[model samples]
Target: MTDTKYRKKLLMALLAAVLMAAMLCGCAGDSGDGETSASSLDGEADAGNRDNAEETDQNMELAGSEIGREFTERDRDSSYTESEAVQIELEGNSISADGRGVSVSGNTVTISEEGTYVVSGHLNDGQILVDASDSAKIQIVLKNAEIYCGTSAAIYIREADKVFLTLAEGSRNVLGGGAEYTDTDENTVDGAIFSKADLTLNGAGSLEINAEYKHGIVSKDDLVITGGSITVNAVSQCLSGKDSVKIADGVFVLNSEGKGIKAENTDDSTLGNIYIAGGKFTIRTEDDSLHASGSIVIDGGDLIVESGDDACHADADVVINEGTVLVNSCYEGLEGYRVVINGGTVDITASDDAINAAAPKNASDTGNQDRTSRQEGEMQPGGEALQNSDMPDEKESLDGEPQNGELSQNGKLLQAEELPGRELPQAGGMPEGELSEDGEMPAAGGRRGGQMPGGGDTGRGSIENDSNAYIKITGGELTVTAGGDGLDSNGSLFLSGGTVCINGTASQGDSVLDYNGIAEVTGGVLMASGSSGMAQGFSSSSSQCSILRVLDESQEAGSTVTLSDSAGKTFLSWSPAVQYSCVVLTSPELKLGETYTLSAGSENLEITLDSIAVSNKTGGMIQNMP
Candidate 1:
């Protein structure tokens, strides 16, 4: 008999033994054919028996080989027969099959009804393909076996009920296109491990997944990395999921050209949630290191992110209650809606405003409306006298009573006493001091006098000018080094408390500095010093010209006139209030390097000077000399 016929009989014998074992467990008997009816078993017996049988079957699937033994063997020289059954062992072992067509090297390795399986091992340089045309399940227990794919993934489960790839403590799985020199236009398969099921990584293990085009681990369901060291280096997003990718506790390092870990959902209602309760994660990417379209809550973990863009980005809120997050980015460090720093120290420095709040729209219009509404509410209908009913009669008469009932003549009814004494006379109306024609005040040498209105007496009028603005140093220490007015405010400057030191020059080097605001000293101390000698220390240019005059007689005395320009150049000098006889030195008009002589009643004064500063209007000194 041929080898194919011999293996066919052996497989049939193994199946017969398995069928007998199933029947002894109260399963339905098989009809001489390979078909068995599960409906004939007792209802409760069927459910309980199937559960126990499958559990026992999975455990006893591979029972024979020891470490470093061949898990299965297949005939590479002959055609496959129906009775050829590949035997798989549970111990550390390897498998070998045909290189071109479908080959099996396991006890009960089922495949998808219409799919192909490409299995490769690491210890050998050969690959095998197994094709199954019926719906079946395959469970693989890798122990001390090294699997490598030449140009495809190590294990490909196209369409199967389930595919289990387990790596023992000392086993490895490597998948990469073999080192070649051709740059052809052929599809090169990458990615170490690829699965289409809910992937779970448990036990103390290490998974190093490196891909050129795709990600390290691609799954359709949730990818849960419970406890393992998973290092994924991919061109695309490192670890992504259609639903969510959770890292409960593990050492996950992701280096990707795209986002390190992206959790997004197409549907808004089924948004993904990236919850990192505990893990040691380090992510470095060219884009946002950690991006989540949904919410990202880092309750506790060690996440270190370095990216070219925002470190941690989320479409919704990102709450960081407790964790040591060190982020260094070229752009904004942390950006989100209503960013609340309840705890933790976040040191951020940007080229622009470090921390900014969005400004309110229509700010000017809102402020104007608020002011107008406040003023309208404080309005009163009548004057003060009309509102006070308890005012005495003498007080009422003093205001301007209707007395001596002669109708008070024609135009004299409203006398001076009818108005307040603080009211000044109008320009073209009756002058309160001296009246002239057309009820106006007379000019200096114009009309003399006119009788006072209401036969009231007129006295000599007096005018006092008390219009000087000042700046008061209130609370707090304010040091001002400004180009213009040191401290200026339109309203009253009440310096309740604080110290203000102002070091400001009026012009370039001119000593005459001006303070355009009211400087009041209610509490704090103010130390102000001008540049040099340009007259007024601090002066106001307003109509109420407030000025703090610094009179230095020690510098300006006996001035057989000492004059210094803005460049500190001493120009011309002469004596003022002197009886001149020969030449009167009236305003020297000295130029650069020019000297002049003045004779006052036989006493000659000789003055020598250098470059005169025309910009500063500096001439000569005036003094009472012989």
Candidate 2:
């Protein structure tokens, strides 16, 4: 018998074994034609074998968006019969292929037909160029192939309906590019693997790519990776999908001087998005680890990122449904016009804001396009100083409260006349007093006017400039340690459920919870600690109880801060990683007209909750509260 027939029999034998195993499990049965019946698997289980828990408990349904579910049937298929496959072999600089649509000239091999092509052996300095008809679909199986091009991509797909590059099972493949591009074609090719058509990679093998000049892999259309072990090291972007990049399942290790993975199509908002359903990614880059011009959605993945700039940045919105995101180091952890974390485990250590929601800027106004060449600490192009319109009025207060109707500590409204000796900080001037020995400003007896150290205001209610921007954390365990603001929203902040712990900036200009609009927490456990100079707590409109306390002295890092009810049952506890003088906490368990004990290192205080939002920064406020 032929080798092809022998392999066909082996495949049938494996299918039979799988069908027998399914029958034994009572989940499926064979149809007597060497095939498992799909309907058999859908039958109701016997009472004795039924699971105690609902099936939904084991397999949680994906969100309504169902993002990145466009992979076609052919994109996920990697099987090929030996009889129908064209075999191409490369030995050093020599190549041999007798296929009808394959043309070889010197060391370059070109494919012009749609069929399964198995490529193997080593090419010293050659290219596998695919120039098929626009409607043709091609599949190239790399069976332990090694290819390198001196001045262009080793694998270039100029035209095709779609291409599937499958790494043959158990085989290892490598594609490398030189330091320069000598191609003068109309289409610029600048990656080890450049595809002008839609590209899909799926298989059970491994592929390593090295790009010395530009990107490791560039797809002009959509780029989809369903399976494979891919390692890419590039000078610019490790992976660049102009339209969209969707990864269903893969093992990726990417390192680049520029962006690790990015979608660059800015013309259409829906086209320039990234969606990762399942993957294991370790990315280190100088620019954003994952950037999209539109939106970025992480449904399921394990991403470990160390970036010189933002770890995950999107010009539109960024939504994390379910994933494990560990940003070991970054300039900003996650930034977008709208940032929403529904269900995930996110831990970020950043030099700037950990979670920031700012208005989207124009492409030219944003400096991230050429960030690799920009100098650190230098102002970006089109940067401008803060204008008076950007700051709130000096007389305004937080949460849109009128100047004369500011809510006092015990939920009683305080009139302007009630604060006789109160003084508002002047524009570009400090309060008329010297700093205390502990570097704290003396209490002004009542709430100070909304004013920053500079001419800008601390911002009251919704910021007029970026009113549409917001940050919403519905469900997640998010922990952040930052040198700047922890959770910053230029517009508003909404926390409905989850656990948020922030060890924020020690600098006086930043705060742990900074928002221009209302910061409302209906249900959640929040513990934030940072400098007291510009600290802002949850708005009085929140349903859950909250407290903002400014300590007389800064607490050292590693000091335990605990909050417990009158019965001494601890509900919230955290140890900050930086020295902090301000602490804010909110939880559903904290009720009105209840007493709680707050322990900060060596100091302890009993706080009586008289209102939904409590603050100790107002002097003589506790004495006046009935």
Candidate 3:
């Protein structure tokens, strides 16, 4: 073997070794990349599982919190068996007969025995039925509890003595399910507390009763809400008491299909009284807002009633002494036996009569007869007769018979004292004095009698005019705008004090001051205007007549003048003077082809241009001036 051949063989061997090592290293690098990819996939799966677990834990916590705060547990042993009588005590604390911190799951708790039972916790929840079974005497007090009854009333008491259910401070009692369909017919959940006894609510609490079919609070006796906020969204009556319902103070919001508050007595002898002394009451109903068979008295507090029917309907008197009462009704605003408004700001907007006090048609026939008799004449004590002896006699008297004279003449003789001294005339009836050259009587003792220089009717005094009806303005500034006659009275109109501005239009085809009564303005300033066309400014037909006498006897008098009546719109004006005139007509001087805004005092005068006739001589003629 040659030396070069041996060296070549060794080099080939070394090269072969290096190539094998390179191939093994490449295979190992590929295996490491696959392991890294597998590890990253596992880490992503673990992170996703952790996030899901956290979300599930959060949901469970929320559910637990809701359940813990929503309801309190009651022991099962505390359950009252069917027809079993149990007595529970409550003194501003929670208690259940089943046991403390135990939930009640039962059929019914029949209160058959007559005793006072106090329930501090939630009364009816989860089929825990409490049936009074028509017991005559039973009482239960529910304080600080949430009672929910599915397809049943939370608390039902029939013929009970007194069921005092008091919601704790900052707590509420919610009744009925959340469904749009009303369950009034069947399976209806009624009020949170329904009682046959005298119902009373006190303290700072709340009762939210949503009855889709029945009343929110129904009581056979008196229902007194002294304190607490009560909300009733009922399909029927909200608060109904057989005797009376008195609200002293609280926030009561009632939305009912029927009456908002009803106090109807079953017996005719017993009168139901609905008195709201103090409280903020807001009622929106489809029917009467506040109805009582006896009477309704609102002494204080703010009351707002919006009803489709009458806002307030009372069989007896409806008295509003104080408070702000706003009523917006489709029908009559207020209907009662006698509505006496002593104090209170009442704003009523009604489609029908604003206030009606007519006697009910269902009143007794004897009552109707008595009312008629009272209206006919006045009654004295012991029913004594006070005849109308001052009535005017409607008889005519003939001439008295002639006294026994010397010749027994049939006609009476005229005495010298009875005749005028200066008068001397012959049988031909010529004046004893001489006449002027123009055939006129002398200025001294003329052909007729002693007369003034001018030939005018001097026998008639200054004629006075009267208004339509007697309008007594005692106090308060009033501004009246009447579509018909301004203010009509059949008697004397006395204006004691206060300012009155009347803008009234007369009847069509009638005079403006077609008054049949006296307008005796004693005090206060009066500015009145009427319609146009043959309408006198002020007219009186009485013998005494309508005289505008100044309050201060020394202040003199004035005349009521008609300034302008352009297009049947009469504007009455007045000016002061020593001697008053009956009516003064003024023709306004309107500019040619220029508009003018005529005003009386501070009020704008309503004028019609068509009724104005522009005269080339004077400015224009306000035709048919009042």
lDDT agreement with native, every candidate:
0.33, 0.70, 0.41
lDDT of 2 by residue, 413-451 (tens): 443223234432211123323333322222222122222
- Model 2: ten consecutive residues of lowest lDDT: 19-28
| RMSD (Å) of each candidate, 1 decimal | 40.8, 21.6, 43.2
Off by over 4 Å in 2: 1-67, 363-465, 618-626
The candidate with the higher lDDT, 2 or 3, is 2
TM-score of each candidate structure, all chains considered together: 0.35, 0.76, 0.44
Model 1, residue 566: displacement in angstroms? Answer: 46
The digit string of per-residue lDDT tens for model 1 on 457-497 reads 11111000011111232233333332222332211122334
Ranking by TM-score: 2, 3, 1
* TM-score of predicted structure 2: 0.76
Runs off by more than 4 Å, candidate 3: 1-107, 110-144, 150-152, 177-192, 366-626
Candidate rank order under lDDT: 2, 3, 1
What is candidate 3's CA lDDT for residue 117? 45
